[model samples]
Target: MGGLRRAALVLVLPAALLLSGCVATPQEGITNSSSPSELIPAPASGAPTTSAPLETAQTSNKAPVYWIGRSNDNAFLYREFRDVPDQDNPVTRALRVMMSQTPLDPDFFTPWQNPKKLATSISGENVITVDVSADAFNSNVDAAMAERAIQQLVYTATAAAASAGLIDSGQQVQVVILVDGHTDYVAFNHVRLGAPTSRSAGLVAPVWIIDPQEGDSVGDGSVKISGRSTAQGGKLHWEILKVDADNAKTAYLNGTTTASTNAVQPGLFTLSANLGPGRYEVRVSQVDASDSAKELFQDTRGFTVK
Candidate 1:
């Protein structure tokens, strides 16, 4: 590969995990379904909450939920922060929503069924125990899709934990899944449960729309589209398409943007547009090196300009 393409790959993909340095172990008997639920160690009871109280409390109720979506003809995970009702159990509530609730993005979907019961607890070692009923595996999936589904759970669980401050984000976090308190059970008849699983590599969308999420409304007609994408040769393509009453789409604007190759937030890119009141779709894609006119990987989101 050439130097530019190589750099693009490094910026686009997540850093590889160095598991050799990790020495944490899962606590035995804590995997039982009846184990008391404790979302990691919190401040001792009756601590002062006056410092940034409103921001802290509001964040406590928000959970980062991951959903499976198609991109580049394959399945990958996408994320959205949802306001869950159960503030005390962010991880568990996020898992329940992942299995039972529909994703806010229409392009995303979940194959897991609503389990009769779901629970989560994080150990001091950063290992999350998720004990769920067997009914969650009701949906059938092939080996490949099933693996993504399991990762869908892994990503959601880990994100929730990190967001809720249940685990230190700097440390390596893993998830141990259990179906009805049993280990080594095959999930969706494909992937085996019970082992500590970390977020899998290459499961994230190469290009995604972060701001103005699907179905969002831009009240002032000033829209800002931002996302992360692999910039082949430092170039990415974006376009805004207007949707007509009959569902026909007409290209309204298009341009090329450069992705950041810096150490912080590599592949991050953003653009802005002003439009009249109407529905529109914003698309971001990486140009195919082999074919200039073709797109290698693309992501899109639909919203309204009110």
Candidate 2:
């Protein structure tokens, strides 16, 4: 909190919705059977061809369609870092460390999904609120999971704000997350942890690497962008945005599905996109399945196809 001034408050969210059965993932990129193979081909250098419907588009014809990058970079980050934040910044350094170990669930992340949900503020005596969702305490996520989640907010926020930093470190950080907001049913169960709290994970890296391993150049056909997540849980959404300029540099689309629970299990998703030939930024977000804060991690990698 020394070098930088704290922000008043900020919020962020995930970009996803519920799915019926299990979400299908393409595997042309990764090794998981659950994921689908992405179809992202290299854009070709040529003039636009406005051909009439040769053979009406088919329902099953998987193709890679290229488009333009509507917006650049993460909108949430743009707001927090670029926009005017309160003098007391409450999300910095340490928080990134905790998230590296265990990513927050995208389902609960509110900022992007819900702009109003504020995680912390600098106006008052550094008020901190932690919201828990229904799936916050899944069978697999036990004592360690709960402990880490709390610590992440505490360490990260305190490090960002000044007053919050003065607050008692040993005292528990107050949180007000929902148990089951999505479902009509609600069950509140206490998540107990071992006596001595373990130290949060060391500075963790949230970057993911996505690549089009499948033979490039599927001209207006199904291609693939394969890569790996630091861990798992977040669904795999894709975007193929193609930016048309004097330079055929940027253009692509995107697709994704969380790899948690039945709706979006830990796996892959196959999508269809078309590109002529150009540069692309394949952005993949890895949000936890339970954390109220979504977009725990995002990987925007560059790729080229023949």
Candidate 3:
């Protein structure tokens, strides 16, 4: 994945012109705030216990896995679904993927390297605690990058725990990091690791292209582009650009689509685009109403039209 690269073009249109009367909102689940009362319930006292081989517990299940990717203006974390090995503790498995530094998308990446061992357990308070080997602190990034790295772990663990039925869906979860079982260590020599961290979609990539995944081929003339976002009022902008294979040149399609999402939680947006047989790149973005050129969140995925 290290050697993969591709070019992208972002054309920002004036918010007033593009957003006028284009508010088609969709219904979505409400995202619950992280609270002690909302934590995953621990096993009941005196429950019967059974032992199973770790090998047997390694069954495959598809769940969302997030990675860091770059847009024309910003670098943000986004998610994609992948098969993970089932286990008694799904949060640990999720964290393992985060630390693995391998993403299915070549454009995405992780800063994790060396001494990647990690252990996770949910506390009675519903706070998940992650203990990492000393080697986890090997990175030398700045403060902002360090913060994003921590959130990546938090988001992965919380999402995994929710998927495993350990926590309720849409409820936020918190995480605490301990280096070698000690909370005194600092991450990347910048941010303190002694405090508990919670999920913040604001810190993550705001837009996700869930359908027509990277390099997919669609026979239908129309393709549905869908994903989640945290933009204000759940409003997002999308455009399709036809890419020329010979020179990598791109031409804008007919018109841009505006999709709406739930404001309180991450909202789902779906839009359909009709195109002739060709190769194209679909770009979705959330532009700051105050500054059209300042893109708060954006993502692009290439697919084939057959």
Quick one: ranking by lDDT, best first? 1, 3, 2
How close is each model in CA RMSD to the real structure?
Answer: 14.4, 20.7, 17.4
lDDT of 3 by residue, 52-108 (tens): 100112224755566778765456677766666655356666676667647766778
For each candidate, how many residue pairs have backbone atoms clashing (under 3 Å)? 0, 85, 0
What residue pairs clash in candidate 1, if any at all?
A: none
What would the per-residue lDDT of candidate 1 be over residues 20-83, giving only the tens digit for each residue?
Answer: 3333344433232112121211111112111100011124466677898887667777877777
Candidate 3 residue 112 C-alpha distance from true site, Å:
1.2
Structural similarity to truth (TM-score) of each candidate: 0.78, 0.26, 0.69
Whose TM-score is higher: candidate 2's or candidate 3's? Answer: 3
Which TM-score value belongs to model 1?
Answer: 0.78
**Candidate 2 to truth, TM:** 0.26
Ranking the candidates on TM-score from highest down gives: 1, 3, 2
Residues 90-122 of candidate 2 have per-residue lDDT tens digits of 332323222222222221121111122223333
The predicted structure with the larger TM-score, 1 or 2, is 1
Q: Which should have the higher lDDT, number 1 or number 2?
A: 1
* Candidate 3 to truth, TM: 0.69
How far out, in Å, is residue 51 in model 1? Answer: 34
